[model samples]
Target: MTTESSCPRCGAALDEGANFCGHCGLALVAHPSPFPPGVSSLALRERIAELTAERTNTDEVLSPLWALLPLIAVVFGTFIGILLIFTPSVEISLLIFMVGSIVALALLIILNYKLVDRYNKHLVREASLRRTMIEYTWTRGQERGTTDAIYPYVSALESIDRQALMDEQPRSPLWSLAFLIPIVGVVLYFYMLYFLTRFASVHDDRWHAFAYNIHLSSMVNGDMVPPPLPKYPQERSFILYLLLTIIFSPFLFYWYFKLVDDPNKHFQEMGAFEDGFLTATGRALTGL
Candidate 1:
């Protein structure tokens, strides 16, 4: 049975050996390939594999160095102070103790700041990888919708890192001077805390939800950052702190530290699930 072939674009009957539709300008090549030119399954798999390896290396580098360096500083400062305290002469001992304390404190602050800077660089890399994953997903023609879901997380995290620097003297000399003032310093300190808390809350709310399946309390410590997670950005935690402070001084530190310890567990969980973002995106393109 002889039949006429119609143009896919405009339903006009396609004449023999027609290269394109006369009506709507659609190309009708005889030997069309299933995959787009220069875009193949193997190329996508290689890209996905490269991203997975890069992400793995990033996670390895994104360690708990920030958590430990402070404690190291504390130990060093305390050891030096103790040694000076045990010296023989009273007057000379006091002067040496003061000098040593100042030096140790300065070292601690500098070291901690350096560690934080490294961590911030890591956040930039992590953000870039996530952006790549989202973009690659769309590039494969497998998913619909925008790839703008994770940028807020990255920006919010950077905000936390920068805001935390206000606690340092060199980075914020005005703050150092302001703290010398009595009431105003106290107000400024709390304001900073409130701002950071809200920022942390936003990160946990928007990005962490997509990043993790486990709750913070259940999260494994020392696997990455130890718990206590950051300051509980919720108003409830703030009210609880106030209430606890009024009731008993001893328990305040406990709750405060608890609020301060928010270890990030999102990336660790990424490799844990087969349906997780990294795996899912790769599979969508490779079908493996």
Candidate 2:
């Protein structure tokens, strides 16, 4: 003899494995399949998997290439600067260095713009993925005549929006001008460092931000953030090294790479945190 389960909503007898109550039509499952009339489960899974894999591959391939940009810039800039320094005519050296600085500055602007654009695109793609997951979860639950699991995917989308906003804002241009001042430039350099650290430390997952910032701080100090030149004669002597490096555009490029790499870490951290939140929320909402 078959046993019957009472409907949670209507108290009507429900057959085993029945999606809804035969008498009152109350749902039995938490998540009903929401696949459209034509789409198969396997097809949906394949599409999601493919998109996810593509995103992962893109990150893996682009990250290292971005990291290397600074090294390349520094090397090339140094070579050109060195040639200018050793060449017989001081006037020619100065001219060449000026031209080199201009070229480096232009390249930096272009690369920075491109990286930001790409980062925004990634965020958009992730947003779409999160939406798809939410839809699938809800449809599946509803089809089975149950309450839809809602929390995990919704939270994930929120996190993505937050991270995207952070990435979209341009870094302060005022700090760039600080390098022109005499003794103040040194103070400004540290100020910029503090600002960046604070910026990166945001988000619900603090540890991820902290760890990511540590790597970023290292990159900045080691490759991009230069020490302040002294104002007096003794300090002024140190300026020679700065001036020489300035002629080389690559060092600047390396710094740009370092800055760009920070965002990737930020995005990944946000994505993972959001996904976890969504899953937990879904389970809780479904009481499953």
Candidate 3:
């Protein structure tokens, strides 16, 4: 039952102890290894574990600091907002309020930009790593000369790049200017909140969503830059102002947290899921 082995490069019998095909002079040792058809379960599990560990390590290094940033902005903004509310004259109050608001807004904008930048960079790194892993797996599989057992993990890296580009740019001035209308302003504020949350979800960066919500809340409350004072002194009654903020502040904070934590949740349902996946992930990664 002896069968002759033919040279891969030329149809000639391979002789015993021959390093090359006698007829074609092609090296026999240059042939690829005939390994198993597919990746072993043990090796697959090991790779999964390694990837998970790397993700965990990266989260540990980045999450806590990011989570604390929004909280800090809220506390500082609240203190300044209260102080501006108590200032004696409308002019003085407006001046102090504008100063505080500008500082808070700038802080929020800078922090948000930095966070988004870092997130995009992380995505690029992950995409590159995944590509290399896929190529290596493919090469190994090809060498074994099996066509049936391909496990492709190729991701659309271009989609990640496009999303990152969309996130970095500011909304058009036409849209931002629409915030000047009283009724339209409220609508635009909520719209922006929705946009940021959706953006964060696509990037898998929930902390950015939460932070943007808080920042938007601060912006809407006029904590970033105060609005102009009422022309009439009677319209600036302290009692009326206090009543407005007290009645509206809690509800506003509630909505902001709802959008950031779980955009699907209503105001009342928000508290129930405050400590859910997004919050836990943010806390775990940022050490917040």
Candidate 4:
């Protein structure tokens, strides 16, 4: 049951199990399709249509208000401290204030950690989706004779370290232990800002380059390609944030708010790209 074979690119005759086309010199790499066995592109088309039919952005919508949670503990401690002024037992009041502040701070830290962890997980899922979409398109391009125009896209997609994108594994409970010691907790708190700055800088550059190359390839290949992922602008200056924190400690809450709000905004922007991608993918599958 040998079916006739030919070059997908130049339409030249191909011998049995030929790996490369003799006429066009296109590399005939066999990429595994994401589609299930016996399923045609028609199924993919339906899926894409379904995706476009509704908002496909799945990133969790986190409110910036949650970032103000730490302030609740601050206000509570402040109220307790005011009691020291009128209390007959100064030592007892001091003990209660110190113990209460420590407990409140620890609880706030744990709660905020959970919020950040959830956000990072959402980002990881989004990264996986982006990888899947790019790989699917690359495979389809090979089948549809558009591999030459998509090579730059393939290169760009491959340049991104998948592990780095998925490295947002939820923090261990032991991480909160850093808050047990006053000096250590302060150091770790500042370190988090440093880490955030680095994270933003690295990912911003990487994704910007990836989106640029992906869109370049898409434009060159016309409607046959799926639309590129929209780039999210996420460059933040650590020095600026640090200075603001020094001037007014309350600004740290705003920084936390930015952490939640930025990704939500990114998710909103992605809705448009997702719709565009689904429409383009449907057209490509239909053409096939």
Estimate every model's Cα lDDT from 0 to 1: 0.43, 0.46, 0.42, 0.62
* Candidate 2 CA-lDDT value: 0.46
Against the true structure, candidate 3 reaches a TM-score of 0.37
Highest lDDT, which number? 4
Candidate 1 lDDT, 93-192, residue by residue in tens: 7887777667655654454344334334435554554444333333333222111222333344344434434432222323323333577875664443
Q: List candidate 4 stretches off by more than 4 Å.
A: 1-58, 89-99, 162-177, 197-205, 219-234, 286-288
**Model 3: runs farther than 4 Å from truth?**
1-65, 68-75, 85-95, 151-288
Q: Write the per-residue lDDT of candidate 2 for residues 152-226, one digit (tens) a residue.
A: 333443455456455534444455445446988766754443343333333223334322332232222221112
For candidate 4, lDDT tens digit of each residue in 9-94? 78888777776787997767754443344534455445545543433343566667676677777787787777777778978987
Q: Distance (Å) between predicted and true CA of 174, model 4?
A: 4.6
**Which residue segments of model 2 deviate by more than 4 Å?**
1-47, 53-60, 63-65, 71-82, 88-95, 106-114, 148-288
Candidate 3: Cα lDDT at 274: 25
- Cα-lDDT of candidate 4: 0.62
Arranged by TM-score with the best first, the candidates are 4, 1, 2, 3
lDDT of 1: 0.43
Judge candidate 3 at residue 167 and give its lDDT. Answer: 61
TM-scores for candidates 1 onward, in order: 0.44, 0.42, 0.37, 0.69
